[model samples]
Target: MAQHAAVDDLVKLLTKANYDLTLVQHRLDKEFQQIYPHNANPLKLVSRIKKIQEDLSSLKEECRELLAAKQDLIDKARTTLVGNRSLLKRMQASSGLPLISDSDDLAYTNLNQIINEWTVQVRPKTGDGKHDSDSEDINQLLFSAIVQNS
Candidate 1:
């Protein structure tokens, strides 16, 4: 009777251990399934990460190209403005007019006044008078300078 009772107690302990092990395994499997569903491909996660990095790199490259284009445009406009200012100074000197100082807003105002006077003088006084091509040339130069300054 003692031997049979010991065997029966041992069986009960083994059965309980097995049930606990089974429960733990099921819990671990559930957690794993939540992270990576059974129907989904795990390799696609790495591919998605790679695709995001590629998109970020492309966006940075596009920003660099746009900045370069804007800088090029600004440089060209500055060059044109400098050329126009130099031409205006030369015209003033060649016409025996005093050199307008290169400093201050007052100088620019004086230069504009001179240009206006020249334009007025160049126009034909009589309605039938022939237009001087020289006057037309000066008018075009003055117009370009005004546009550049503005």
Candidate 2:
């Protein structure tokens, strides 16, 4: 039937678009990596939002290492961390289609913000320069965000 042929054409068109979209995503990732080499590119961060959320949820807030740190750092981290839950939900709503789209500026901004805050040094605490072992988890998380070739 003509309708079946039309549907086949639509699927083929969408497949081509999706392929083109991936190439664009990689190009964007390379550009962003230059500016944010230490942090995960925002697009990759958004793509991995679920994995990050799971890692965040499993953190032991009561770890002695975290408790001794300045309160402000903890406070700000808490505020930023809460927003990721909603981001994960938004990604879920998109289901099979790529989450990256022209209309996702807010989500992209939020994800970039999260990546910024998690970068190695949030602030300079006035104390011995040594850092706690538990806090290193966050450092590793950020480092892992970088693309392997980057």
Candidate 3:
């Protein structure tokens, strides 16, 4: 679950790297110039410096991609959570139950338990003459659900 640096963290890192690269660039130029007067062997080290720069560029791009993916996941999760809450509210209304508070409790709540509670509220009492049709309809729905699941 460990993620790469956040936007501000990356900014801070880039700031430090920029300063360090400035110093390193100046020193490398001075040293390379001093060495070049004696021989041409330092060209191999130039490739090494360029390699470091290329690696740094690749790393920055990777960090940016990771951050965007993390943000996209967060956006998707927020949308799903909001839709679930709306559905829960509608279920409460239909069941004639008091609405659960929109709070942290929802995170801990068992979805199955809430569904069972709603069914209990809506189900007709046993042996009640007035609700026989409603009871039959509920039974049919339950049977259909079981068949579908199978």
Candidate 4:
């Protein structure tokens, strides 16, 4: 029960972190959109975009850390529950109690399924510009603009 509670708490944390990341990405998208329409100060705009990219990179690192922590918690909970179930089965068998066969196995399967679903849902978006091809064009525009200005 305690392990279940711990896992629940970690899931909540992971959800919150994912939400925070979404907000950050949305902000970055908005900022990126505004950068292209402006005809003023290409150097300044490039500098600003570079800073935003740096911040986005940092946020991604944080998301990765949170994901890793959530994975660790799930692993620990799985290990502890499996160990407890094994011990209980031994105790029950020694006491001539009727064995409940494969109950732990079912629980473990369900837990793994749930964790896999959450992992797929909560995985952070990669920061590589390939995800948004427009970003590549924008980078080229910025480069050309800077070169022309210089």
Candidate 5:
């Protein structure tokens, strides 16, 4: 009878330990979800964040390329003006075209006019703070800079 009681006590202890362990695991699982709800399925959330980062990086690269292209165009236009002035001077000397009083001044004026017209037509303009109904991704910070300049 004593041996039987001892065996029963041992079984009861084991059962209690198992129940406690299960309770602790359930509590831990709940805490884990609270801590990182999005990471409940970690692989999926990681992939989504990676894709968003890639898209932002691509947009930044495109903006850089556009700015570089604009700078190159400005430089080429300036070089063309210089070449045009030289060509005009040569023509006046050899072909007997009426010479301007100041060829350099005329060239500078023409370049300025061309640049002004190009800027007005090609540059993006920013309007008021009201968002456009059609466009969703307009960055307010960048648009504000454009507005101030305009």
Candidate 6:
């Protein structure tokens, strides 16, 4: 359970960090636009744009590492659970315990259900095409505008 909690926390932190980085980049782009206007020095603008790109790239790499760490934790937990369950089954068979219906079957089913629910809850949703699509479009527009201005 603690391992699970730790993985969940890490995922949350990574998600928040990604969001914050995006917001910061957006704000920086806006500021750059305001400061540079149309007639600003090309060399300065180019340098500033390169710096922002580098920062964004570094943030993305960090996000990817965090995601990979979270996945590794989850995989370790799953492997441990599977091994434990196999051992339990072997012990039960050796002890001549009343062979209840296959416990492993039930455990796997429950684990699958829990994982499905967790995935649904943690994933970001893309709403119906009308309203939510506008945000994505706006982001693209902003990105292009920044590149063009730079």
Identify the candidate with maximal TM-score. Answer: 4
Best by lDDT: 4
- TM-score, structure 3 vs. true: 0.39
Put down candidate 4 lDDT per residue, 2-94, tens digits, no spaces: 999999999999999999999997887677668756644455677889999999779656755555566567668878987988898899999
**Model 4 local distance difference test score:** 0.66
lDDT of candidate 2 over 1-118, digit per residue (tens): 9999999999999999999999998888889999787677787777689787776655533342343353346546656755765576587677754454534767556755764564
lDDT, model 1, position 92: 89
lDDT of 3 by residue, 1-150 (tens): 234447778889999999999999788777877877755537657787899999977865675555445445544655687688889889999999998775545562554355455355434333353333343354444444434455
Name the Cα RMSD for model 5: 14.1
Candidate 3 or 2, higher TM-score = 3
Count clashes in each candidate, considering only residues at least 3 apart in sequence or on different chains: 0, 0, 0, 0, 0, 0
**Model 6, runs deviating above 4 Å:** 1-52, 99-110, 114-150
- Residue-wise lDDT of candidate 5 within 1-94, one digit each (tens)? 9999999999999999999999997887677777767666454567789999999778766765665566567668778977887798899989
Per-residue accuracy of model 1 over 99-121 as CA lDDT, tens digit each: 76666547455655654465454
lDDT of 6 at 141: 39
Candidate 1: give the clashing pairs. Answer: none
lDDT of 5 at 39: 69
**Superposed Cα deviation of residue 146, candidate 1 (Å):** 37
lDDT comparing candidate 2 with the true structure: 0.59
lDDT agreement with native, every candidate: 0.62, 0.59, 0.61, 0.66, 0.65, 0.64
For residue 34, what is the lDDT in candidate 5? 78
Candidate 1 positional error at 6, Å: 57
| Candidate ranking (TM-score, best to worst) | 4, 3, 6, 5, 1, 2
